[model samples]
Target: MAYELTDKDLLDLATGAALLGTGGGGDPLIGRLLVEQALADGCKVRVLDPDELDDDMLVIASAMMGAPTVVLEKVPSGREAVAALRRLEDHLGRQADAVIPMECGGLNSMIPLLVAARADLPVVDGDGMGRAFPELQMETFGVYGVPASPLAIADERGHTAIVATGADNHRTEWFARALTIRMGGSAYIAEYPMTGAQVKRTAIPRTLRLALTLGRTLREAKQEHRDPFDALIDALKQTPYEHGQVLFSGKVTDVSRHVSDGFTQGHALIHGLDSTGTMRIEFRNENLLATVDDRVVAIVPDLITLLDADTATPVTTETLRYGMRVRVFGISTPPIMRTAAALDVFGPAAFGLTQPWQPLEEIAN
Candidate 1:
């Protein structure tokens, strides 16, 4: 049976989703506001387990794809996201029975809630990537050989494109990125059509509940005047991977950004409070690598999270800026991200470096 979501649930979902975002998902604040508005206007978000989906039911994954920075500067028209989904449905000749979060982190989690409330469809309580990733092909959808093509991309300006291709997911990622750049560096996308069975087999199950639990833990910890990071670390320790370490706690001193090949490329320098060295972070709409004193400390696949030093709130790649005090935390990557195939696809070399990939746990330990 499907479940109904309350405001309390939304809070928890955001918390857990941020932890999983691995430092790349956009901020959940705006998304949470959108959902809150919807709820106030009498929109109720319904959630369903993967088992509740019918075999013949059509399902679509939706998310905002772009520079998380740009998303903040140019607020969404609110309709563009769901409009993209509807356009995809029109092209597919079927209505999506359930909407699923493309990734379980930050804004992506809340996005589906808004989409479900607006579309009046039930949202599957699962996600493609249990965490956030930089590209379209980073999710389990790609691991499962699900194609992201025939995707519908829509902008706040009402520009829309339905791209179809027979190429691989990498090619699809390149194409969608081009379209997104053409649409001013950000757009709402709906792709990866799958059945309930496909969803059940490929998705990170019970993610919504996980998100809620994480969020609630943070909230309750704050209410009790406890260390929020302690709560987060505790919750994460329950998961499979090792919780590496807390490298630094400090304020952002500089953010250098520019457009490179139609993508946002940048680096942030964070001033440390408890350490003698400064932390430098490089990103491509996601934190890709972190270094201290010119030594690489953490890299992608293994999670590198930035949080408000005081409140423990997550800071997205786009929102990272000068003068923002933050804490840096590392978690080992899941086994999938460490695979040879996955590394070739997303490692430093894939991002244009000739350097060999090193596990975060190794460096931190």
Candidate 2:
């Protein structure tokens, strides 16, 4: 089924994207504002289900690549996103049949929508990464053998570059990262151009809907003066992520974070409210590992999100600070994302940890 987005839906979607972002993917507020402006300008965007697409349809992924900290200060002009999309379309010698998000987290989730509205094209209701990852090559599309090249990158200043040299995905990341740093540390990208059949085969399905639903669930729970965590985990039960469990509830005792190699990398220490457990979380744009009392509680490809305990708002790495009360939880990734092939691209080892990727449920048990 196809549906058009309303003004309020953007709000909920942004909120949900932030949670799904797992402390990375740029800021959701920026995405929300851009989409809000598009809607205000009377650009009606429709979201088409993957099944609605013909096998021959052309769908391209739109995203922002850079250090999350930099994007916060040097906000995009929105033109960059459109420029990236247009550049890619020109290179392909065909207008995109639909726009899709590289990841359904934070700003990436909304960029495709913004590009779709601006280009007068429909946006697909799915994404390559069901949640955000720091690097371009980590998406399921790449994991499933979709080439990342023919990628178009554009900056806030309207400067654009294309990676069409037939580089492998890792080299593609290197080229794009170099371009992003030179373009003032952040960029909008349109890449992984794929046929509808490839999308159905590789993209995680219905993640846009999940992002919207998550926002709505938390918002409605708050309105009713209910516990948003309970509401949120319950909401997860109905999605591809399945049920999530709170791993620790505590106050942030310390945070060590910095931007390294075009990525935000760091760790945080949280002391349990009951003073019994201490949670240490390590991250690279997105949370990658979590340990309590030196025992691994959660690790990469699984979702480790920090939420404001009282309000249940998702906290990104950029905003984490000492003395904040929070609840941390881990949710399973989609099965496609947990496969051995997928793990080779984004598992703990990929992030410099030796622990092998295991089912989140298995670790929880």
Candidate 3:
């Protein structure tokens, strides 16, 4: 079935995207609002199933690749994202017939909709990562040996560069990080040009539907005065790993952020309101680890979500600050991400942690 973009769909899209993000994707609000604005402006965002594409159709995955904090302070001029895609297309000497989101989490999920609307192309109903990861090379495309280089990065200041490198995925990430730092800490990137067959082989299928469903479930649960967390838990039950503990329920008491090596590294401390104790979260653009009383409760590939304790609305790591009451929840990682290939791309060492990768289920239990 064809997925039509609508305001009602944003809620599910955000929720499902967050779940898929596995703790990275930044916050979804800005992207959600941007998509809403685009739709309001009469931009039609159409979702095409992966199978609908011709084998030879050239498609590029596009998204904002930088510090989420930077995105908030320097709101996009609204042209750089699509411009980046176009620049890549120009460099590649091929017109992109469709656009796919690199992932479905938070900002990434909604970004393709906006890009597609502006570029007048169909947004694929799938993504490279069913969820989100921090680096440019963490997508399923990378896992499948798709190079992230020979890509495009465009800034709001009208500066654009077509970055081509011979490095592997991790090295490509390092290069992009350096460039993003020089570009004032954030830029729009378009990479991983692939055919439909390649997409089908590497990308996570039906992620768009999952987003829509998660969003819709959250909305309906709210309208009916049901527990949104429970609803989210139910939706994610079919995925790998077990549901973890509710780490904390409190307001953000502190946030520390700095841009280094082209990534935003930060920590957020939340003081509990209910019985849940104080929780500290460390992030690199996207939330990476959550600890309560110095005990690791959640890690990447598993999800660590911040929601308004009362309203159950998501709060971005960038926007999290003093006195914002939030309920912290956790979910397990997908099987694909738990694999050795996936870990090499996003494991503990990949994020600078010396400890080994441990699924949240084990830690929580």
Q: How many angstroms is residue 71 displaced in model 1 relative to the true structure, after the best TM-score fit?
A: 1.4
Q: After superposition, how far is residue 342 of candidate 3 from its true place, in Å?
A: 0.3
lDDT of 2 by residue, 1-84 (tens): 999998879989999999999999988898889888999999988999999999999999999999888988998878898999
Q: What range of 10 consecutive residues in model 2 has the weakest lDDT sum?
A: 356-365
lDDT of 3 by residue, 130-195 (tens): 667778888778887777777888898988888787547677777777778888878888888888
Local accuracy by lDDT, each model: 0.80, 0.90, 0.79
Candidate 1 vs candidate 3: the lDDT winner is 1
Greater lDDT among 2 and 3 belongs to: 2
What are the per-residue Cα lDDT tens digits for candidate 1 across 125-229?
Answer: 888776777788877766776777778889998888887875487787889989998888778889888888888877767778777877787788999999888
Candidate with best TM-score: 2
Sort the candidates on lDDT, descending order.
Answer: 2, 1, 3
**Which pairs of residues have clashing backbones in candidate 1?**
12-212
Give the TM-score (vs. native) of candidate 3.
0.91
Off by over 4 Å in 1: 240-244
Task: List TM-score per model, in order.
Answer: 0.91, 0.98, 0.91
